[model samples]
Target: MSRTPPGTRADYAAFTPITTRWADNDAYGHINNVQYYSFFDTAVNAWLVRQGLLDITASAEIGLVVETGCRYHRPIAYPDPIEVGMRLASLGNSSIRYELAVFAPGNDTAAAEGHFVHVYVDRATGRPSRLPDALRAAAESLRAPGSGSA
Candidate 1:
């Protein structure tokens, strides 16, 4: 999804600190590729929950992941923490695109970078729904002004 290289340390907004477990590593001795997406999911949804936009268990408006992509630059191993940085790339009427970068603790470069698009839908009918006002504003706050020009 990116034309440039892996994200550097400068591009993100809020960071969520995450602990890595021994099981997070694969036989190759690094964090498995699939686990990176889990980090991305946690970082984004945690923000949604904290913003009071998502109930997860009862919210009628649910955001379902429709698309996802990632780019890896380095390997991460257990015994180190992760700083998962996140930002909103776009806030649409019914969806939002979230960009994420996972950096090893105390490191300035990213181990993996990715984006996920979630389309808000009705829990009962599973139909697409417009984003709530509060959620849109929260998403807009994380969007860089000039980042979505294209």
Candidate 2:
């Protein structure tokens, strides 16, 4: 497979600034590998919440992450402010693929990048559900221009 080059903030549809906590650093002093996934989830969910598309506690439909992966290009440590850039790669009947990148403060290139796929499902029944209209529209708005088949 071809390697994906690190992305810049401009490549994304939206950006969220994240403050790294002291607890995020590992024994080696860099952020733990798993924390990148936390950043991914935070960025996407924050956008969805801001758009009035997600009601974590009461929404009839909720997104359940089905797949996730990340590529690390450099180390990010506590005390370093980070930015998470996010964009939609595609949207399906009940799923959406979100692409994300983590940028060190003031850096143009991503320190890490990744993607996660979430399938919308009934909160109670755990079965696939059609993407809610508002959510779908909001997701569409996050599609990067000329980037993917969203």
Candidate 3:
């Protein structure tokens, strides 16, 4: 299988800083592979919260992660300050694809990179719903040039 190249800081539209917790490390002595996904989730949702696009307790709509994948280029461990870079890869009526990269302090290239797709659904009905205008606008602001849409 072919591997996707790691992205540079310039490729992302937004960034979130992450602190590596000691418990995030695995028996192998580096952050567990699964923890990378948590970083991705935190980065996206935090951005949404900051934009007032999400109110986790009472929002009428919520984004449910539908798909996720990651590629690791290097190991990062506890105490290493990292940053997660984010960009919108695609936007759809009911879903969005977020591409994210993890950068070690001072590095321009990613130590890990991946994507996750979130399908927006009505919180009470659990059915797909069109994205709210504010939410859509917030997402659009994160789109890098030449990104996708549907």
Candidate 4:
């Protein structure tokens, strides 16, 4: 497997604090690999909600995640109060790519980093829809410098 270098807080535009629970640990004593994806989702949605781009119950348009990936640089165990950093890697008419980093308390470098892709769709039809102006603008605000043109 190829190794992925950890990213720093400076690489992201926003952050969400997350606390690891006892259940986050596994038999081996570190966080379960599956939980990392949840952190990514939480961080992304938190930003969207903060920007007023997502209304879970009433929005006609919603983002449906179509792809995701992660690379762990170190183990994160229970009781670690971490922060998940988020930034946009790419934006499109109907899609967006998000880059995320999980940082241990007081650490500048990420313990894990990942990417997630979401395709905007009409909630009723489940068909691809052009991103709303507000959503697009909000995403642009979080675009990483030199990452891509929004």
Q: Is candidate 2 or candidate 3 better by lDDT?
A: 3
Worst 10 residues of 2 by lDDT: 141-150
Off by over 4 Å in 1: 1-3, 145-150
Candidate with the greatest lDDT versus the true structure: 3
Off by over 4 Å in 4: 1-4, 145-150
TM-score of each: 0.91, 0.94, 0.94, 0.94
- The per-model lDDT (C-alpha) reads 0.87, 0.90, 0.92, 0.90
Q: How many clashes (backbone atoms < 3 Å, residues ≥3 apart in a chain or on different chains) does model 2 have? A: 0
Which residue pairs overlap in candidate 4's backbone?
none
Error of 1 at 116 (Å): 0.6
Task: Give the clashing residue pairs of candidate 3, or none.
Answer: none
Model 1 lDDT tens row, 51-133: 88889899989999999999989899998899888888887889889989999977888889999999999999999999888
Model 4 lDDT-worst window of ten: 141-150
Cα RMSD of predicted structure 1 = 2.3
Encode model 2's per-residue lDDT on 1-150: one tens digit a residue. Answer: 988789877888888889999999999999999999999999989988889888889999999999999999999999998989999888899999999999998799999999989999999999999989888788877777667656
Question: By lDDT, highest first, what's the ranking?
Answer: 3, 2, 4, 1
Native-vs-model 3 lDDT?
0.92
